[model samples]
Target: MSFPGVRRCHAHRRAPLHAGHRRRTFGGRAGLVLAFALALALGVGGTAAYSALYGSIPTAEAQDRVVVRGGVVRLGTHVYLHANGSHGAIGITRVALVKKCHLRVYLDRQPGDRVVAAVAEEDEAMARLGVQAGISGGIDVVDVRLYRAGRRVCANDRIFGGRSNLWISVTTLARTPRKPATPAPAQPTVPAAPAPPTSSVEPAAAPG
Candidate 1:
């Protein structure tokens, strides 16, 4: 007994209720799944970026030597003393000298590894007060050199030239060791068959 317009209006209202129910059931789950996936991706990406930027920093002891006037003097140095491992950066934090003199510091890397150098001041104070020289990227060997104002000086090699006591301190960031490999499972051992009973009778004297 309802009019045609009223029936149509009732149908339209019921359609919206069914649609809303579907949205509530499926839409929320879909949204949650999408959010979780996004979060996981972001977390993984962040960790990778951090690893790439800063691989690992290694612990090492500092070494020093005296600088004297003579031929060119080269100091062999390393960030990690135990092994020639990978390093991201090397820095000379402080340098102590007995007297003020013109000095130059250089950082040399391996042939294949990335090479980077930190600029040092050209003034003479760099030798006495020390200058910060840092380089980034993987390096195997680092060569350090100390120069007098104009002449190459060898530490402890000459006795007649000006000598300056030098002690240099450095800081570095190096790569860490990889995860240990899992050990293989032990194999089960099989017992050897009992040796055939030794014939103590000597074959009964061969059928005597």
Candidate 2:
């Protein structure tokens, strides 16, 4: 019961665990959990803010209204009305191809007055014959000729001091021509039968 080595072994086995080691392990785990929760909160807040801002943005049609209010350009098919004495330029914002197309201008004018109209490629110089207005005249149909590549392919014009409307129609003249018909083969002709042998017997009887 008094051996020194056995007493030393027994003391080692009863040694107490250090409290600082336990605190270090627990603190590290807690720090990681706190960091994760903070990151998740920030992400959720950012997403909510972005969604609210996106919902407030205007739609395509709404933006078009804003552009129209700014008076930049009328972006639709527009019908303009002018009284008998009104004279000015009318701008058509619709885009169209001039080649192989026809522009028709219908006018109602006073009988005695004449309305001079012209068609050009630009809005400012739209009236190729200068600014002309009708004074006293009846309703008239004015035809504006448009040319493309030195050939008359379309019609466009401007009218002043008249009750009128504009319309466009495409022409079929610009279409490609049909191919020529193939020549028919010549038919073979049959030889006519020789006249039946003249009755030599009849001629002999007449002579007798």
Candidate 3:
């Protein structure tokens, strides 16, 4: 009932439309796969970067348990002065002497010992470990601990609490050698009173 030329034209049109639809479907699937791969790669990279940056930092619990093994803590001799040069003789600074701010600390599971160093202020140390008024309670002296309140701290590493240099908590405080006292000068010896000039003649044998 239809002409052969018209039938051929309809078939050609339908063929191109089907082919375009298939191409679009394949392209969308390829884009989705590529997007998923890129996202996964970025996620993995971010995780690794985070780990690398923060892995070396010890946990809060680990820092809390760090024990002060031994170190020299001395009372500061310098007097504190206000901006206007007031309050010069008020008090002394409590200091913990370290070689270079590196402290030897003991941990729970460590074999020997570990060194911790910091160059922070008194407030930072106080916040890390609460300060007490005295060393009687066996407090750990890592950075700063207030054994005596209302005292300025001199050492950059740890702060002790009291004025007592005899720290019972520390294993042993290295003692400073005392300089020997100088001997007193000797008194000049007065020459014995010159013997009365022996008379050329011994007084004639005591006047015979």
Error of 3 at 38 (Å): 42
Supply candidate 2's per-residue lDDT for 183.
88
The residue pairs found clashing in candidate 3 are 133-147, 143-158, 144-159, 146-161, 147-161, 148-161
lDDT string, candidate 2, 42-101, tens digits: 774544344333433223322322210000111112323222343322232233322434
lDDT of each: 0.34, 0.33, 0.35
User: Can you give the lDDT of residue 179 in candidate 2?
Assistant: 42
Cα lDDT tens digits for candidate 1, 1-208: 6686565444444445565466445357686566556656777454444433444312221112111111122222211111124312233222212233223333332233332222222223335534222322223323333455545443322321232233322232222332357899999999999998876654455554
Model 2: lowest-lDDT 10 consecutive positions: 67-76
Give TM per candidate: 0.24, 0.20, 0.17
- With a 3 Å backbone cut-off (N, CA, C), the pairs that clash in candidate 1 are 56-174, 68-155
lDDT of 3 at 59: 44
Candidate 2 residue runs with Cα over 4 Å from true position? 1-100, 116-121, 124-139, 155-208
Count steric clashes of candidate 3: 6
Off by over 4 Å in 3: 1-72, 78-141, 147-163, 166-208
Lowest lDDT sum, 10 consecutive residues, model 1, at: 61-70
Give candidates' CA RMSD values in order. Answer: 20.4, 27.5, 21.9
